[model samples]
Target: MERASRSNMQSILDYTDKDVRELHEQALENLREIGLVNPVDAFKALSAKDSKGRNTTLLEIREIYVSPNVGTEDRELSRIITLYPEITIEGGGQYSQLVLTFENNRFPDMNRIWQILESYGKESAEYRENIDDYPMLQLTILPLTLDGRYGFVMSSPIMWFLTPADPAEEQPRQIRMLIEPGGLQFVQDESYSVEKILEESRKMMASYKMDLQRQLDKEEAEKEMQREMEAEHKRFLESNVTNHTFGYDENTARTAENRRQAWNDMQKDGKFKVGNKRD
Candidate 1:
């Protein structure tokens, strides 16, 4: 009896070993036979052809036009909305706006003010992932230059929610939170003028906005297509149902129904349109 038990254990181990080995072999074959596909030609070029470590494709992107500064009286400086860089703040909390100010207590030259602003601007951590953090507002440059120093400020309104409760009353609704009198700072440099800096900033801001808009448009189109596919799937499931004697699987029917509903929704939204405009 002991011998028989030992033989059974050995057989189990052998079978397990063979199955694992076969799975590994199959995975390896799949990897080698299926070459990786680069989603973009630029990525492929970067890995296989571009030797200079430069984004040649990205450099070709068109920039937005900058308008000349018509001065302070002509324009109003209102609070613009800016999203926090990270999804959550450092303490596991969420923030709607963060004020980033540049101070100029060091430099005291008037002519070199623009130069200083440009230098500090370059170092500012205004860039957020995917460029849609402040969809409603654009980053603008300030010109307050004096005594060889210049000032640049970034201002944005914040949005957040607060809930209040009274057992007998409804909970407080969401409110728009804002950070007023946004932060500003001064930098010292004489290389560029305040007008030029502001122009550059506006141009950059416009370009970022355009890119974000295009990306959103593309995503919307993809979502519409997915809805259409789901609708078609639902149709198939409903048409292929079995009677009580040969009952259909509830799980399968539910899945197919979901897919079909998605497709139908997409059709109703008119999401699947191929056009030269997209091109």
Candidate 2:
């Protein structure tokens, strides 16, 4: 009986080892889903010093424009949206307004801020797993600078390759609107065209723009109120506090008297050398 049990265990091990090659390939696919695709490329893409690293490419993009200081005013610059007329597999996606803040506290009002994010997104887009299927994509440049480094975040709704690839015989369809939970699993509709996707993307962008406009309005109102309050305070001080009254004249007289006394004493002291002033 012990011999039979040993034989059974040996047979189980043999069966498990039968298709190691297929098992290895499946394991690699699973590993890719969890994100660790070309670790060397990913690491080099993120490295600030490695410009011409192995198996990696660098794309330099710069945004050149003048925007009104949103801390004070809003301009028509943010209203410009892109429809992506030339839609490449790697290039064209319906993107919302590219809102850039033009202010002095940040970079100068009209300086080209380098955008190296295309290379970053190209390498790192695979890691951005979808939280949900609802897509809201925008290329936003914030008015902020620190330690001479201005940066941007690579954002997308799916873990997609942003760079162009060799045209495939059949490309995967765009993510369709799921009416209910797990709707995608049950349905595979082929009706979602590029135009439809662009239309939906436009709507999403419009909604985002409205929300942003409201926020800008609120901020402008607050700034106006603050400026008014500051002006009022200045006016009040001007009316109430005269130079001759409120001890202002007395303080000035006392300071001048002390300085004059110091000068007289220094003049009398023959030993008051210039070197002594340092001490």
Candidate 3:
């Protein structure tokens, strides 16, 4: 019966925007009417209003932003954002600007949802290759998973802004993979359920890191070796020139002279400086 319930819940995860919005509205309504302040900061923070007069509390929504390079486009990003919740960064409220999530775990606190949001924003900045921009959107809960397996998830249409697709003729590009570690970063060997996947991913990442280090070391060694060889060759030439000793037997010297004469004869005439002397 429990398993069936879980299955049913999973099936409802893709509820349409209207469906999710209704549920989110219900949750907010419950919170407002009940005056529940268990997580007081988050309760108040979520109630903030923006210039347009719509905020998370009023609309009961979350907003997810896509790559700015893609611009505001629903068709360009809807599939990517909705399909890959595991690796997506989530944010909400006033502290929303400073948190990031991997799984449901926030670096600072896990029990508190508001702390989790702040942590998600912080982590996003921490892990991002570029910190100049905050890319996470305001995400609210309904179909959202608080399972600690994802940093954040959206439950309704009101919870996110629809990314507008460009009208330009160019076809949108598809993401090959979620390069960011995302929730996978939080898995530890101790978690019995997630241990196997976590361990394997760790091993693979370790191997790749080691291979990269080895390649860098090899390149450095090769460069050093080349430098040494060059120095040795230069030294050898210098030593030979300085010593000015042709370590040749009488026969070898005679042969060298004969070749020299042959080369001299090949030229139409000799062009020599006035003070030039031949040994």
Better of 2 and 3 by lDDT: 3
What TM-score, over all chains together, does every model reach? 0.27, 0.25, 0.24
Give the alpha-carbon lDDT of every model.
0.31, 0.29, 0.31
User: Model 3 off-target regions past 4 Å?
Assistant: 1-148, 153-193, 242-279
Model 1 lDDT at residue 273? 32
Q: How would you encode candidate 2's per-residue C-alpha lDDT over 22-113 as one tens digit per residue?
A: 33343344335635333232222222221121111111122223223345332212222222111111123343212222112122111212
**Candidate 1 local Cα displacement, residue 62, angstroms:** 20
After TM-score superposition, what is the CA distance of residue 28 in candidate 3 from its true location, in Å? 26
lDDT of 1 by residue, 72-138 (tens): 2222322211111111111112322322211121211111222323333442346555442222222
lDDT of 2 at 112: 17
Off by over 4 Å in 2: 1-81, 84-190, 242-279
Error of 3 at 202 (Å): 1.7
Query: Number of backbone collisions per candidate, in order?
Result: 22, 0, 29
> After TM-score superposition, what is the CA distance of residue 243 in candidate 3 from its true location, in Å?
9.6
